[model samples]
Target: MRYLFSFIGLVYSSLIKLAVLFNPKARMMERGRWKVWGKLRGGIVPGGRHIWFHAASLGEFEQGRPMMERIRAEYPDYRIVLTFFSPSGYEVRKNYEGADVIVYLPADRISRVRKFLDLVQPEMAIFIKYDFWPCFLLELERRQIPTYLVSSIFRPTQLFFRWYGGAYKRLLHCFTHIFVQDEASRILLGKHGIDPVTVAGDTRFDRVISVYEARKSLPLVERFAATVPEDGLVIVGGSSWPPDEEILVRYFNRNPKVKLILAPHEIDKEHLLQIISHLRRPFIRLSEATESNIDRQDCLIVDSFGLLSSIYRYGQVAFIGGGFGKGIHNTPEAAVYGVPVIFGPRYEKFKEARELIAEGGAFTVSSAEEFTSLIERLISDKGYREAASRAAADYIRTHAGATERIVRQIIR
Candidate 1:
C-alpha cells in the first residue's frame, strides 16, 4: 500500500510539473516547492518547542487561524511553523506575522517527509480540515509525534469507511486525537473504532465572529452604503463567480432601486470587465470610488481582495458565491453580522450553510427566479427579513467557542 501510494504521489507530482506550462496556479505550486528543503532548513529556528500546522488552502487556513493565534498566545515559547499544500494559501499568507515560519509543504514522499520531520522535529503536528497525506501521517506516527486533526468533517462515502479502505483507514489511526465539527462525524469515527474523538464544532464560526467584532471601517464601503436610500437595500455578492454574477446581474437589471456590492472570487481584469458588461446600472470600481462621489454610483465593484469579510457589514442581504460551482463560500462571515444569506443550491457540502438554511437564516436558490423571489421578499418584508437576520445571528453566537474548546484540549 505504501509503495502504491508513493507511486501515485510521484505521478501526481509529475502531472503538476507538466501542468505548469499552461496553468499559472500549477506553475506557482511547482515554483513554490522548488528547492523547498533549503527554504525549510533556513527558516526553521533551532532548539525551541516547535508546533506545526498544515492547511490545504485559504479556507482551511481560516478554519485553523483562531487556534493558531490561541496557541501563540498561550504557549509563547513554542515556535509556530505553518505549511500550506496549495499556492492559494501559501502565496497569500507567506508573510503572516502569526507564524514563526511559513513554507509550502513538500510532496508527501518517504524521503521528503523524513527530511521534513528531521528538520522541524515538531513537538506536535496539526492538520486542519482534510488534507491527509498518507506518507506524512505514517512518518509522523513512526516518530511517535502527537498529531491531531482539527475542525474535521467526515462523510460516510469517504474511503476510510469503505470495505476496501484498509490502507486509508490506517491514516486515521495516526492521529493522537481527532476534533470533529459535528456529532455525525464523531459517530462515524466511533463506528470505525477510532476512539478519542471530540465534537468541537467548526472553528470558522469563532473566527468569523471575531472578524465581525473587530472589522475595520472601509471608507469606500461606507460611502457605497450611504448611496442607498434609508428604505432601500444593499445586496452584497461576496466571493462570487461568473454564474453567481449572471443571476445577480439579472436581478440588478430588474430592480435598479436596490444597490449592489459585487466582490468576485477572482479579481482579474477580464472577469471584472465581464461583470461590468452585464450590468445595466452605473457602477464604479472600489479603487476609483471616493468619499465625495461614491454615493452617485448604483453599484460598487470590488477589484481587490481582503475586504469581502468586512464588507458584509454594509449589506442587508448577502449572496455568497461558489455555490453554483464547487461549493459555497463562507456563509458565517455574513451571518455573523446578522444579515440574511442567500446562495446557490450546491451548498449541502458546507455544514454552516445547511444549518443556516434549516434555521431559516439562509435561503438557497436553484435558478434566477428563486434568487429574485428570495431577494425581493427579504427586501420588501421587514418582519421576514428581521426573523432571518435574528436566526442567522443566533446561529453564529451558538456555534462560537469551538476554538476555545479545541485549544483547551490541545493545551491539556
Candidate 2:
C-alpha cells in the first residue's frame, strides 16, 4: 500500500510539473521550490540535529508557526526545516523568519523521501492538521524518527474509520503522538488502537489571540473613516466569492451609509470587473488608485494579498467569504479583530463557527434578506455591536496557547 501510494505521488508531481507550462499558479509553485532549494545549497543547515515541520497549506502553516517558534527558542542547536505540500502555503510564507530552510515537500516517492531525509537529516518530524501522506509516514517510521501529528481533527466519515481502513489506520501507529483538535478525534484514533492521544484543541485559536493582542491602528483606514463620516457603518466583505458578492450586491445597493471594503478570494481582473458591474455605487479598485484617488471613494476593493487581516481592524462588521461555495475561509481571522462576523450558512463543519455563534459574536444567514436585515440592525444598535465584540474578543483570549502546550509535551 505504501509503495502504491508512493507511485501515485510520483505521477501527481510529474503532472503538476507539466501543468505548470500552462497554469500560472503551478508555475509559481515550481519557482518557489527552486528558490528554497537555492537556499539549501548555500549551506543553511550543515551538521546539526534537525526538526522538520510539514503543513498542507497556509491554514496549517498558522497552526505550525507557534510550535516552530517554540522549537527555535528551546533548542538553539537544532535546525528547523519547514515543508509545504501545497503552493498556497509556500508562496505566502517562503521567507519565514523561524525556519532555517522552507521548501516544498517533494513527491512522496521512496527515492524523493530518501533525498529529502538525507538533505535535512531530521531527528524529529511534525505533521500539522489532516495531511497524511502514507509513504512519508512509512519512511519516517523506518528511519526511527519520532513523528507527531499536531492539531489533528479526525471525522468518523474519514477513510481511517471505514472497514477497509485497516491499512490506513496502521499509518496512525507510525506517529509517536497525535495531538488532536477535539475529543471526537481522540475517540476515533483510540478506536483504531492509536493511543497516547491528547485533545489540544485548534492552534488557530492561539494564533488568532496573538493577532488580536498585536492589533494596531491603521492610519490609512482612519483617514478613510474620517472621509466617510456620513457612512456610520463599515461592512468589511472579506474573502468573498461570486455567490457571496451576489448577496452583498443586493444589500450594499440599498444601504448607502454602510461603507464597504471588499477583499475577494481571487483578485483576477475578470472577478474585479464582475464586482464593479454588480455594485450600484461608484467604487475604486485599491491596486489601480493613487493615494489621492481613494479619499473620495465610498467602496474600496482590495485587489492585493496580505492586507485583509489588518483591514479587519477598520471594520465594525465583517462578512467572511467561501461559506456559499466549497467551505469557508478563516472566520477567526476577522473575529479576533473584535468585530461582529456574518457569513452564509453551510458552516456546520467548522467548530469555531459553532463556538462563535454560541458566544454571540457571529450570525449565519441563509439568504440576502437575512444578511441585509442583520447588517442593518447590528449597525443601528450600538449595544448589540458592543456585546458581540466583547464575546468574540473574550472567546479568542480564553482558547489560546495550543502550540505552546504541544511543544511542552514534545520536549518532555
Candidate 3:
C-alpha cells in the first residue's frame, strides 16, 4: 500500500508537469513550489516554536481562519506557517498577515514531507477540512507529531468507509486528534474504530460571525443599498455566476423597488459584460462608484474581491451563487448577516445549506421560474421574510463557539 501510494504520488507530480503547459493554475502551483524553500528559509525563525496550518483552497482557509487567528492571538510565542495546496488559496492569501510564513504545501511525496517537517519543526500541525493526504499524514504520525484534522466531516461514501479501504483507512489513525463538524461524522469514525473524536459544530459559523463583527465598511456599497426607498428591498447577489446573474439581473431589471448588488464570483471582462447585457436598470461598477454620485445606481456590480461577505449586511435577502455549477459559495457568510439566503439546486452536498433550508432559513430554487417565484414571495411577504431572516441569524449564533471548543482542546 505504501509503495502503491508512492507510485501514485509520482504519477500525480508527473501529471502536474504536463498540466503546467496548458493550465495557468498548474503553472503557478509548480512555480510556487519551486520557490517554497527560499520563502521558508527567509520567513521561518530558527529554533522557534511554530504552528503549521494547511488548507486545500480558499474555502477551507475560511473554515480554519477563526482558529488560526485565535492561535495567533493566544499563543504569541509560536509563529504560524500556513500552506495551501492550490493556487486559488495561495494566490489570494500569500500575503496574509496572520501567518508568519505562507507558502505552497510541498507535494505529498514521502521525501518532500520529510524535508518539510525538518525545516518547519512545528510544535503542532493542523490540516483543515477534507484535506487529508496519506503520505503527509503518515510521515507526521511516524515522527510522533501532534497532528490534528479540524472542522472535518466524513460520510459513508468516502474511500475510508469502503470494504477495500484498509490502506486508506490507516490515514485516519495518523491524526493525534480529529475534530469533526457533526455527530454523524463522529459516529462513522467510531464505527471504524477511530476514537477520541469530538463533534465541533463548524468553524465557519464562528468565522462568518467574526467577519460580520469586523466587516469592512464599504461606503459606496452602503450608499447604493441606502438608495432604496422605505418600501423597497435590498437584495445582494454574492459570488454570482452567469446562471445566478440570469435570475438576479432578470428579477432586478423588472422590479424598480428592489436594489440588487451583483457581486459575481468572476469579475473578468467577459462575465461583467454578460451581466451588463442582461441589465435593463442603471448599474454602476463598484470601482467606478464614488461618494459624489453613488446613490443614483440601482444595481452595483462588485468588480473586485474580498467585499462579498461584507456586502451581505446591506441586503434584506442574499442570493448565493455557484449552486447552478459546482456548489454554493459560502451560505454562512450571508446567513450570519441575518438575511434570507436563496441558492440553486446543487446544494445537497453542503451541510449548512441543507440545514439552513430545513430550519426554514434558506430556500433553494432549481430554475429561473422558481427563483422568480420564491424571490417575489420573499420580497412581498414581510412576515415570512422576517421569520426566515430570524432563523438564519439564529442558526449562525447557535453553530458558533466551535472555534473556541476546538482551540480549547488543541491549545492546551
> Any idea what lDDT model 1 has?
0.90
Clash-forming residue pairs, model 2: none
Given candidate 3, what's the lDDT at residue 193?
97
How accurate locally, in lDDT, is each candidate?
0.90, 0.84, 0.90
Off by over 4 Å in 2: 31-38, 228-231, 288-291
Q: Residues 201-266, candidate 2, lDDT per residue (tens digit)? A: 788887776666776666666556566554377888998999999988778787778778899988
Once model 1 is optimally superposed onto the true structure by TM-score, how far is the C-alpha of residue 126 displaced, in angstroms? 0.4
Model 2 TM: 0.94
lDDT tens digits, residues 1-412, model 1?
A: 7767777788888999999999999999888898577777887888878999999999999999999999899889888999999988999898899998898888887777888989999999999999999888988898999999999999999999889998899899999999999999999999899979999999999899889989989987887887687777999999999999999988887786789999999988888888888888888999888877787899899888788999999999999999899999989999999999999989887888999999999999999999888887887899999999999999999999989998898877
RMSD (Å) per prediction? 1.2, 2.0, 1.4
* Model 3 lDDT tens row, 70-168: 988988898999999989899999999998999999877888888889999998999999777888888888889899999998899989989998888
Cα displacement (Å) at residue 207, model 1: 0.6
Worst 10 residues of 3 by lDDT: 1-10
What local lDDT score does residue 84 receive in model 1, on the 0 to 100 scale? Answer: 95
Q: Give me the displacement of residue 346 in model 1, in angstroms.
A: 0.9
C-alpha RMSD between model 3 and the true structure:
1.4
